[model samples]
Target: MPIDDFDLAIAPLKDLGGQRVWSLMISLFGDLARQEGQIIGGPVLSAIMSAMDVRPEAARVALHRLRKDKWIASEKHGRISHHSLTPEGRAQSQAASGRIYATPDDLPEHWLMVVTDDAETGPLEKAGFTTLMPRLYVGDASLPVPKDAATLPGQAVPDWMKRQLEPASLAESYAQLSDALHHVARDLAGADTLTPLQIATLRCLIVHNWRRLALKHPALPRPLIRDDWAGLVAHQRVAALLAAYPRPDLPEIATA
Candidate 1:
């Protein structure tokens, strides 16, 4: 591929942990196959990974690690291989899918908040609740609150609560991603047709960057969301690009 053909709009994802081969593999499968029993054949998996510049040996190692960690399971049919997420892995991925693929129109009207003076707040934060304060966590109504914690129903969102809902830098990050998405869109529009490898590469990068941002912020209601926030625009552009470059056939993505 020529240097000009590739668009690294979001060239450097800052402050993120180095992209691990195993983690990227998990993200790929979660994006592509989580709904379809998370099953993928060896050749197809390899082809997609290769499109993203992953080495075959590195993929093999990552697959082994995922299986050992109980995140994935594999089966063999003669000489060919197939892999699927383990039950535990599917549950984790499904939980995250709600956030990653969520639309503004689908947001709930009410929210649930758990306030306690105990040490259970750590678990709540890990489970996707946004920290309103030291012992306070706010989440959508669907979020599960601890049995002993007091649940508060959202009525009118206060300014203080909205301020605490998102980090100061989050809005800026959304603007940056929106800009990057626009660049990618314009670049893709000029192309006649993208090869399967090119399509795979572009999709993977977009998904990876978007996924990180999506998971970083809690799902706040319109009243709480900042007027200048660019998340909605970024998501809309990403959806359109993904639609235009639908996943290519396995054979077309294969390099060997």
Candidate 2:
């Protein structure tokens, strides 16, 4: 069936969290308008937020917060305000995009482990290690590893270690997001063609939630990841859906 009201179709996504306005705005800008010179005009931004059921005043306040935080810069051309990521903000967004849009194919083949020391902890953490406990770190073998460390190669992780990597709360969140994503995929599959604004809003909501989960997930080998890991399933679904609803240009969305 066609989606008569976009909000109802995406209720699972909207209800996934508290819908922090500023954070949602960040995801909106990051997903839709983070490129250099890309601008999301006030009306287009407003339309997307409104379609997602965000209140006008809440969006305004979130914009204000982004401006204050130096994550976004705005210009007033006539009565409309156009916003784009700041240089620093753009760089930050770009860094995050690596994770947010990464595919399941990027999962590492072998995981490297290090029994890190106090000083080594900082470097290991920087190198993307998941600390199972004090001075115990595991990360992708593809990334740089430090000297003076006895590293081990692992094809699979034990339940005890997996518990540390995939905490109960994180797994639950992933499962919930996965269910919501399947809902969206089904909804979009049968729905009528979406407007630029509608497409942008839906993409942002999915990316926002995926970003939250993906960023927190430990970088690990394919074998280390659970066979039924919801996060992995969610990752696949997100990738497919994003491909299905390709991003629209800023101008197209703004003019719509």
Candidate 3:
């Protein structure tokens, strides 16, 4: 069958390592398959290694690992061994494409919320507090504080707290949290309704961009806006809507 666009997107990753190694493996496989009907033994492997600027032994090890993992199947034809993807290998390639190429629209609605608070509270209370922190609380009191009480310099006066604080670090942390919430909302709410894959991608994006966002908004009080709880409620509503949708089998590629 002709390769699908999604398959092509994940083709370079079949060996399942870092981008460079994956690309090299894909390239070598393509070259060998195209030049000869099959690939076998040291010479072909050595040429692939040279092309990739990796050692021959490294290439041999990678090839052996791919074979052992059942990513490729081989048959001895005379002195040469021909290798091709097994049905499982083809399925794996397709799955990788679904994971890396499918947009949030392809995912289903369901969200995982991670709530953190400075105080120890019941799970239900924590959920409610995260949802209502901005509107229910007054002024700066709604702001997130260090969880460690011992870290408090004194009586916890806001002005004194500001002076003692690292404004840059604070802003960075708040920005990181805001960015994470934005993604969670996007993925949990759905393309039409939230999908797990979308949620996961959003979560991943949050982790990836966290440091930069944090640096940009250091020391800013949580919920810089008094109406921040409204957004959280909106998020909750979206999650509920997604929950109403029928759940699909979580795709294997989505794990980890």
Candidate 4:
């Protein structure tokens, strides 16, 4: 309950908007507790969520929602509560891990186009295609293109198209996250060890923020991605910081 450098380190991410409590908890669980037999005690959850500026009432509401939605299961042990993802939830989290944690170098290198009517765009878009124009969608070439597939000649994206894809707001958000992470690295410098709560809180905030931005668009090819894209830098910072603060097993956190 006492404050330390982590108090300063977590301030920037605290006031950021668009953070849904349930989704943020999902991000936390996905990062550290998605494995079988993993469970987080109420005290650990409170510590991590408090550090992230989540209120107790809101946290309880999120737990209720997760339970009702069958995304998580909670247990009562004497006067304390413990939580873990349901089998369904763990499977969903596992499915997204590769995309969420992939290195920038491992991003897709080729892309293709699919021409579909408005009615058919829903399924393709859900599959990670970007709507470049009406009836035209662009996505990773590795995916099986539909019947109306079109080859991307030279795999080049024009200046106008690049502008359409990478908006100023998106760049700014990534830049902000990248800056915040730099500050965290600065604050935690010379730290030889950190409590499990500290590590979980940092990982949750970083991953939650990054996932919101990274999953906003498909993993487009290098040619399609802008040279000055802030996401590129932010992605590197996320990977590096996550490595530096390796996630602890659930037992360490449950008893912290």
What are the per-model C-alpha RMSD values against the true structure?
4.2, 2.1, 16.0, 2.6
The C-alpha lDDT values of all candidates are: 0.71, 0.82, 0.36, 0.81
Which digits, one per residue and each the tens of the lDDT, describe model 2 over residues 70-91?
9999999999888899998899
Task: State how far residue 207 of model 4 sits from its true place (Å).
Answer: 1.0
Lowest lDDT sum, 10 consecutive residues, model 3, at: 130-139
Q: Report, for all candidates in order, the number of backbone clashes.
A: 0, 0, 13, 0
Candidate with top TM-score is 2
lDDT of 1 by residue, 86-137 (tens): 8888888888887776666566667777787686556887766778887887
- C-alpha lDDT (0 to 100) for residue 65 of candidate 3: 74
Error of 4 at 237 (Å): 1.6
Ranking by TM-score: 2, 4, 1, 3
Give candidate 4's TM-score: 0.87
What candidate 2 gets wrong by more than 4 Å, as runs, is: 1-3, 119-122, 156-164
Instruction: Give one digit per residue, the lDDT tens place, for model 3 in 1-256.
Output: 1223322322222222232443345433432222223443444444334533466667667767777887666777687655655556556544343323222233322212223443344442332222223122122233343343221212223443333333334443443344444444444343343343333222223222332232222222332322233322222333343344322222311331
Per-model TM-score versus the true fold: 0.72, 0.92, 0.28, 0.87
